[model samples]
Target chain A: MTDGIPAAPGTDAWFHDGPDGFVLLAGRCTACGALSFPPRPIPGCPNPDCDGLEQHPHALSTTGSLWSYTDARYVPPPPYPRPPDTEFSPYALAAVELDAERMIVLGQVAPGVAVSELTVGMPMRLVPGVLVSSAGVEERVWNWRPGA
Target chain B: MSRPDSVAVLGVGMHPWGALGKSFVEYGLVAARAALADAGIGWRDVQLVVGGETIRNGYPGFVAGSALSQALGWQGAPVASCYAACATGAQALSTARAHILAGLADVVLVVGADTTPKGFFAPVGGDRPDDPDWLRFRLLGATNPAYFGLYARRRMAIRGTTEADFAAVKVKNARAGSLNPYARFRAEVDAETVLNSPMVSDPLRLLQICATSDGAAAVVLASEEYARRKQRDAVRIRAISAITPEYPRTVPDFPYLASDSAAISPPASRTFRESLAWSAYESCGLGPEDMDLAEVYDLTTAMELDWYEEIGLCAAGEAEKLLHDGATALGGRVPVNASGGLSSFGEAIPAQAIAQLCELTWQLRGDAGTRQVAGARAGVAVNQGLFGHGAAMVVAHA
Candidate 1:
């Protein structure tokens, strides 16, 4: 295993280690209280009645319900972190619905998990995981793990 | 019934779909010329040309309108290009219809074609991670099939749908495809064949998913008065619903990692896919009952079932039941994809929506050969793309 220090890529700045645990960065509409993930250039509130645009940084809940799940049964196309020397491995993916935010966010299931083991509406929690590691760094990402 | 805004589909044509190993422009030109000949008009007779774009082909594909015009000898016809991912063909058709409806042109030619690369379509070569398409593959290793798999699984959980039900869809489409001369895969497949095929995504097999293909389709659309001069009757495009999703969309769609939070604002009364055909039906004063046939995008056998419900063929969660009853098969009450759908043609991208219109044209004109929908009078063609782009069109005898 790569012992490199953990770091987040520029595009994955939303993944953060909060005091309590792993939390996804989101935005809360200052006016209408709308919530959005990866909240840069915070989008306008989705509510048609509200014209509010300004949103402040907010942390999303770490736990949610599994809305759906599947797996990459075949080798995916490039830019999917396949080092030329490594063999492809199928992995499970899940869409978790954050109850508080009332939004569904997609993420990889924790390693070793399979689609057969997951069911819709089951409880899941966010956990820190390494997306890929190279050179002297471990690129970190969030994974959805089964159980509360 | 033909409304005041209806535009006549004077002629339609297509190049056979397959890995023909030819340039996209070449395929488009052949189909365009074929449509012109079928319309009994010369190239110079056209007033406008609309091209559905294919970004994979680089600069020429991006500006396909001008490229096709140049390839056709540049008669100085006014041209426009449209790009809306899988909905490109529909967008191009919509542009041509608008030009005719607004009386900007008496005769317009619409064309779309593509030469897809092998295997899964990857995002354009780049290092920038801002693209959701790139991020999905990089972060989650989620291919297009992954999303389809997700939707399929969700449907199974909610509706008690089974793998056999999904395989049955492929069987039906493959049976129809066998009769379509233009289809790439012309051999009929059985449910067992579909089920036994190697799995590309869990609960979805290789035979159940459409392949990326190289093909082209074209149509000549003209004003009602112009069409009347040459023909006693014509197939008229009654409506084209090129629409987008509403705010706070709760369902997860392609190329998006997160769905809008509906906690603050309630979800729309109709989901995005449902609204597509709804808008078309409202515009044309038509309903699901009025449709004699349909040509829906069958990206996956499972997605086709979804379209049946979204298009109001049946109530929610009733598509599986409808399929088993053979209501959507040829000789049934409302035959769908009588032209074999994407299951046969694979996906020519830009050419697909126009191809759907071509199938509707032939069926409405009583010209479809072996795969004809008997006495078909009215039909609907529907498809959706990434990032909230969707299109649904209604066609009827004028």
Candidate 2:
């Protein structure tokens, strides 16, 4: 995997691969009609009355609106990243609105994006980002950010 | 749930909560033995054992039941381990309670123990987007403190709580913890000390949150007949409720979220924590107002305020007023965290819930020396499992 790909981004297989080779996925309740982006996995619907079960794969919107953003400081432990230096550049973590599922998804802003530049209600897209190593293996991951 | 076969706590034990410089199994074994001794029984009397899990131990949480039993000397009991994040202790005790309550075993030993990581607990290593806990730490760098921070902020927004109001909790719990020999930070703190501490998260200083500790706690639950046969003032676990989150857990809870409802609806205004206590009350025919003493999961100083409302100590937005008015303190109308709570003991995960009972059992029995609630006859312990879950146990003596 190249560190920076202009159009192609993403490292997982839930979402259908596109021209840029971005793969996406979401969570759908087979027991009921609920659709979620990252996917909801509880014993059931979490919706008290719904009591739905079996969280199956659902498709997520490739684009959405920014719900909120915060400049998070601190280098997350392993299974995450270990910045070569201890200097953990605060990244703007955001929850994006995917109106399709009526749910919110969270992701990191693309590597070069600064925290100050982002705002609530900003339009954003699901872009491919570097996948850090996981479970002793390297992989690509997806991130959401404000559109250019 | 039945009179024919009822469950009784026959054994109780624990190691002081702190950097005990020991392994999980060792601590667990010690606590187990204490329970056996307290119940006037032997490990061999236990027909089954259930252990709470700890992630750091790698393999134990899922397989520690037999490990603990073996540590206590190969008693040949059926062993089971459970993992429910913080609620593991209650689950373990609940398992034992079921065994006796179901007439499967006349005597059972339930144990939960953990040696926690020093720093803010993080998800298992690796960049697995599929894992929400890991993703939150990786993508947002939001450690447990961040979530605590969010809750503190929201409490302020929704309830008009202030930093001083939150600090008052630390002062109260610390003073109580100071009297408990098993506590980690025994020094009584003041609101000023809390305000001056380094800020881990906005509106929450370092002293405002619980630390990680190494500890173990065990309880021996027996059938009612077993208790009657022994026929002493044996503490009886009147109720155990392990309830899940409800839809729209809508209690203004985004503060704990590193992200939003990527999955389920927030539970309605009736939170799982609230419902958890409700279930216990239903089972015992009691309510918060009737509680003589309480042991709440003070995961964070601010979270204690949230639990106040959840357990029905007071109505929503009234916890701050209660804290300031000294109604929840040792001398308050209904004393809470009389054993100093998670704030004083730090969190030992699996051991915490059972430990809460250990304190209450001692208090209600009038054995608690300095930290005893004056005439505490009925007590409750409330805890939460991971991914939005809750556990509550009500204990009363006859």
Candidate 3:
């Protein structure tokens, strides 16, 4: 954290460094027992048949397995906040499957992990990281690191 | 069981695909005129017009039906506009078919045109956190190729597919594209060329990906009676299936941060793309074995392989084996992308699905000079778009 505040507000609600460890906020449906990440905005369960409007905030398991991975070799177009072209370096993205949630989540991998170093089915854990540094404040984002 | 009533495709036309410095309206007019002339029907004869919307053209793009009708000298024909991302053209054709089958129109003109911007397609301006497309680009810098790369890597891991298999797709499609006059990239490519190309995403080379291009495609469809009066033999549209994924979609799709969890229930046996093809097969009472040719959305060489399995041409994880056996190449069993595919045409967005239909029509009619699938009878065109849009059409000789 910079300036004693999270760079991207509201993002902290999704993931933060708790006293125990990293926890991901998710939504659990009371009626159908459905679970969703990033929480549904409508306050209702996605299940069409179940009219479960009462959604309770729940913490998701931080550990998962690498379902897939890729390396972005080219620079993407705008609105993607990044350093200048000269400072740019390719980064690897990973899709991790949380066994408890039975869902796959996508995130940037930790800085040092290269594409060659990673393999499918490798265990990974969620960790807080910086997406970009601007105005002397590091934009908080989540990353997947190899090992639980 | 008696087959459902069908609509006849009286004529089909297209504007060559490439980076042309022209407006979409200009290209649309040329394709519309050619289609009308080919059908031997005047513009005034068409009772309805359906146009595929283009995102690049501002507000007018939303009302593409009226814009194209105006460009063709409108005769007060009823107009409908549709947008389903890359599946726009198929939706437009479906709309025209509905009008004809319902007795609302005797003849319908279906058109789709687009002038794509250079570089990777970015989200429309403004920051709307609710917009998934914007979030994907802003948070992860995930371009379209990034998603393609992920799928390719997953296939490699799960199916033991090799990079050489991916490169082989490019070589095969490029060779077919060399015979297609309408294709932008007419030069044949080899495995060396694909391997030597710079990497845009891991496991995918630059030449293996499609580029953005400008193009237009149109078709004239008529009621069974009207078509019989004009020409006894015409290409008949047996079915056009535009389907969305079922709830709890397990597979990862574009513009999404995560896949829907399957905690409450097990994932479906069929994937989203497989279901799309199955819907068309059920609608037409035909299976993959009935197909003589196919034109699929090959946004990347790897994607083409995925389509081969999804379309039921082979079993899961056997697409590479099918390719190696020369079953998907021109003159092979169930030849695919005989029009050279997006690998050769690049992507013109709205125009692509209709362009696929144009190739199918030519092949069925024995009019495709050089790239003809000999003795072709029935063909299928399959495509998927962002935000859960999937479309497929089955066509055969009347």
Candidate 4:
């Protein structure tokens, strides 16, 4: 286990080989062992019964259900990359329900995923996707796709 | 012991709302000066100033309190600019009210003004992975009209709310707005015109949506003791509530949400909008049955239908039926949007909430001509939008 990876990865296996067979990382409360994604920054566990401050990082399951979806019709302002001369296709946005994490993480769906076909309870899997860097450096963003 | 301070609305001013060329700051400044003059004070006399922020304008997104403060001749009064999305103006007013209630200042001015971009306020550009507003627009291609369509369609499916019913609301507001000379659209229209008008989205037409306009509204609020000392009109602002949505705002649940989840626990009380006004009522010690008149954020024709229920006039699906029966008309049980609302007046964002206050103040004082409620003594104003925000305020004559 590579300890102390600053700026925790959303999925555990994200950096191991860079999520082609991507897996997400979450942290579990060492005291209660309750798993959480986007890992808790505060050392104390969220569980009411636990008094522990130590939170150890753990890998979370990548497969989950598509919570909901919508197609964005607007461009987002900064901290996000924008491609000039690239006619951006309006893409599908979805929130996937990762149960073990007990939370919903929102992400852009993979290319050509029809919003009409997506259902509230449909299963989804997170995969490594292209970020198309601002300075011509291809960074990666997480995306969910139907039928893992 | 902190002695509570009550606020009095002195001067209320509104510019004729429409597609004007002037910047929002200019429009708001004119109204601010007019309100100050109405309060028998100059801009320099005000101890504090607050501005409701806007989206289309270049002002708020840049520097707002300074934006208007500079427009009003750099008085250098303590300033705050609030952005509560659709609830902006009320949020602005709420800030001043808080200051007054806390005895921080005796006299304050609240202003909301906007020169809106025509068509819908679309999301800003770029492939943003982190933003929900951009995500909804990009992924769903959901224009503001799409949500309007969804609500209208839902009303039609369940409430028996027809296109004609929605049209009637516009017709009523237009006829009323025509008499005011302050409304953007004055031409009286029939349901036929609404039916025949080109469809911009699924169920709503061009006429059904309030147009973007250039406008400003301002009200000078003074502490109760301060108002008596100044010998000005002593009107009291009862309550202002800015409430956010519950944990999981769902779609079949929320017009803006993409979809709903089957897992999370449902809201224990009322829907988000209903609870917002309900809390306001509890705070103010009044109920919907006691309201003399109301100015709801009628962003769309169908939205007005929902507001009817949210304000407790009727049940969720009964708004359309109530509309057809003439219960919410100009002369109905409770005359809604008595000042042409955002329905007759296209949304002016920051200014819109204050504009609602202006109408309520007039109606309560029995000054609203033609559109006035017969004996309007108590009024409420409600507005909500984008960032899971909702606002409501109660106003009554002393």
Candidate 5:
């Protein structure tokens, strides 16, 4: 519980610091054993047939392989809190394959990692980072760093 | 698939795709009036009007159907507005068809127009945590081009597609665009120019991606019986399919942070884009080999290659080969984007899908002067919008 480190204000349900460190939160259906991320109150499973009404909170895998990657060279418009164009720098994004969940999750790559350093199938691990810092309050977010 | 009764496209009109500083209504009116005149029918003869809604304009754009009807001097026609991102025009056509088939109205006018804002299209205002569109921008700063870049990079890694293959798409489409007066970018581009352009996203240069433009398109559709009565030789719409991706969708589409986990249910046999084409083919009782021409959404040069496979024009991973063989050129077996595609026309959001059909209608009628495909009989238009909205239409000469 450090000042600069907290689950991104409203996204606490999606990511949290587990015993092993940052892990994605998910929901597992008790009836059909289906797993989904961004935990939701269950009365339904994404599966059409299974009448799975009950779901319990589950922690997702912390590491995954890079499925794909790209860099945002242009400044995204409003609501993104982008810095002025002159001070803007591109950041890399990675789509990681969470093998356990059998799904691909997207996130920004850890700061300072250029696009050239990344490759498909490269190992990546989830970690906490700052989305934005304002008025002494740091809005925490998740980043995928190159590692196991 | 059972054949639904076909609808006849009596007329097609468009306000040229460019950065025209005009309101959406003005554009819509121009296209609508031209379509009505082309059909040899008065505006008052139209019984129903369907409009593709634009997200840029606040209240007026939202109620586009009524707003456009009002601008055209409301004759008490029932109005409906639809929003489906870039597929908005196709959805509006679908709505008009539903009315025509249900015996609600015989003649319906469909219009779509947009005055796109400059720069990257951002999410609507506010910090509503529930909105995924806002979250992607706020959390990852992922612009639309970023998503396109990710897909492009994935295609290269998986299929070994080269940068030259992508530049070829621009060259071919731009050549066709030069012949199209409605297209914004009329000059043909070379591979060298595309390669030298500034990189908007990795593996994609400025020339490779479509720019946002202000444009409008309109089409007048009438029942088969009505067309016969009017003695109008019109392009017939055999089928229009608007299909969404099924559950356990493995591919991460735009505006979504994560794809549905395949841990529970397996992904569908066919990809989303493939399903869209299949639905159109099944409904029309026709396959890719039967099509004389096609108009596909080329938001990016790489995307056009992907569409070649999705629409069954070529086998999977063979899109680059199709391009290499000149199979997709104007004189090839099946010409694609004869209307210059989004690469030349850019994107007008709501108007894009309708503009695709306009190209098909003209091509099928042998009226596409300079860019005409020889003796074109059947044509298809395919487009996919954000949030799983996929659309395809089959048009044939009557």
Candidate 6:
């Protein structure tokens, strides 16, 4: 697999390629075991009772169930950068609920997927996909696809 | 309930909503003058002014209270500005009510206005990658409607809701809006028009989603004693809930990329949307049964249905049944959005919540000519903004 450029600031910081597949990075409170995404430093654990300031990097589940799905049929205005020389086309999006994490993560659906093909509670797996490409370089991001 | 502490709503007014090709200051001043006239008072009578801030405009928009006050021939009144995305107007009202109830101010003016550009609302200009609003657009090309569409599809999948059911909401709101002179789209549309409208986000048609509009609304609020002194019958604000979400929020809201992980800690029992109205009801010692009407944020037709359950007007997954039963239409058991909602007046951001209050005031006063809810004794308005801003208010006839 080829490494691609991170699409947003702090993007490269929170995700990476793992032995199994792509995984999202999160901050786990060392004391109370609470998890936060984008791995940013918060004042402390979200738990009001816990004053735990220590945290460690934790990997998130790569597979989940589809919570909901939609397709954006209109072209979004900037700062949404469109690919060079390509006409605008509708793209599907999904909110997938990670079973173990017990949280919802949103992502673009795989390239060929359509809204009609998706269903709520159906199993979905995350895979590396390109958000945009220019000058022989691809902007890598995670995508949800129906599978184990 | 031991008479919940309240503030008297003396008067309310609005600038007709549409692309009026005017400045935010213009709309705000017009609405302010109308409200002051309705209250039968001069600008000098107001002890304080609270303005809902508009982020889209420049520096003056951020300090809207000062701008409106300067426009209204400054009386040197104390002023405050509030910003909470879509909930800005509610926050402004909450601020005004707080001052009146605190004995620091006797009469307060609350105003909100915006002159929005056409098309989807984009993040403010810049390459700030740390900003989630900008990142959502840059990374996923997700517009606000994309989030609404997701919610609509989720409801359909889980609750057996249909596209036609959503269309009915638009049809209902449009008919109500037709009677509202200040609404943007005052022409009623049929279910066919809504169903056939081009899809902006799958499951949400162009007609189903609200447009960006230029508008303003203002209200005059005073202490109950002041109202009694004036010998005026006024609406009383029973409660204002500007609560934020609790910890371990599980549902995905707008602008946020992900929900808080409940892997270790259990999730909050009530969703953030539900909690907004819950706090208002709890504070006022009122329940859904006490409401004669409701003016909920209908950013999309589907969201109107969601508010039904969130505000406890109906049980979860039963909004469709309530709609079919005609319980939420004008002249029904309890009308919702009798002022046409966002379906008729698109969103003017900071102005919306204040506009909802204006409708409630008119209805309770029996001044809403054609679309009035019969003998509306109590009402509620609820809306949530990007991030965790939750706004809700309950008002009763005084």
Each candidate: RMSD: 1.8, 4.8, 1.8, 6.3, 2.0, 1.6
Question: What's the residue-level lDDT of B267 in candidate 1?
Answer: 88
TM-score of every prediction relative to native = 0.97, 0.83, 0.96, 0.76, 0.96, 0.97
lDDT (CA) per prediction: 0.88, 0.74, 0.87, 0.71, 0.87, 0.89
Q: Number of the top candidate by DockQ?
A: 6
Please identify model 1 stretches exceeding 4 Å from their true place. A1-12, A41-49, A133-137
Q: What's the TM-score of chain A alone for every prediction?
A: 0.83, 0.71, 0.86, 0.76, 0.84, 0.87
Model 6 lDDT per residue over B1-398, tens place: 21438998888989999998899999999999999899888899999999999998899999999999999998889999999999999999999999988989989999999999999999999887778888788778889999999999999999999999999999999999999999999988999999999999889999999999999999999988887777554689999999888888888887877888887788778899999999999998899999999999999999999999999999998999999899999989989999999999999999999999999999999999999888899999999899789799999976
Model 1 per-residue lDDT at B120: 90
Sorted into a CAPRI-style docking class, model 1 comes out as medium
Candidate 6 Cα outliers beyond 4 Å, as residue runs:
A4-7, A41-43, A133-137, B1-4
Summarize candidate 3's per-residue lDDT along B1-398 as a digit string, tens digits: 11356888898899999999788988888889889988889999999999999998887788888889999886999999999999999999999999989989989999999888988999988866667788788777888898888899999999999889999999999988999888999999989989999998887889989999999999999888888889734689999999888778786688888888898877777888888888998988888999999999999999999999999899998999999999889989888998999999999998999999999999999999887888998999999999999899999876
Q: Flag the better candidate by DockQ, 2 or 4.
A: 2
For residues B1-398, write the lDDT of model 2, one tens digit per residue. 33542367766788888886678999998888888898898778888888888888877655878779778888577888887778888888888888877778888888888888887787766545556666555545666666566557657755778888888899999999999988889998988989999866555678888999999898888888877787644577888998776654433232233233424453255657788888998987878877998899998888999988989988888888888888888878888898999999999998999899899889878888987788777888999765765799998776
For model 4, residues B136-194, the per-residue Cα lDDT tens digits are 44333456665665556556655667788888888877777776767887777888988
Chain B TM-score, model 4, reads: 0.94
Q: Which candidate leads the pack in lDDT?
A: 6
| DockQ in order | 0.72, 0.24, 0.69, 0.09, 0.71, 0.76
Q: How many residue pairs clash in each candidate?
A: 0, 22, 0, 22, 0, 0
Cα lDDT tens digits, model 1, A44-71, are 8656688888877788888999999989
Cα shift from native, residue B153, model 4 (Å): 2.1
Residue ranges of candidate 3 with Cα displaced over 4 Å: A1-12, A84-86, A133-137, B1-3
Ranking, lDDT, top scorer first? 6, 1, 5, 3, 2, 4
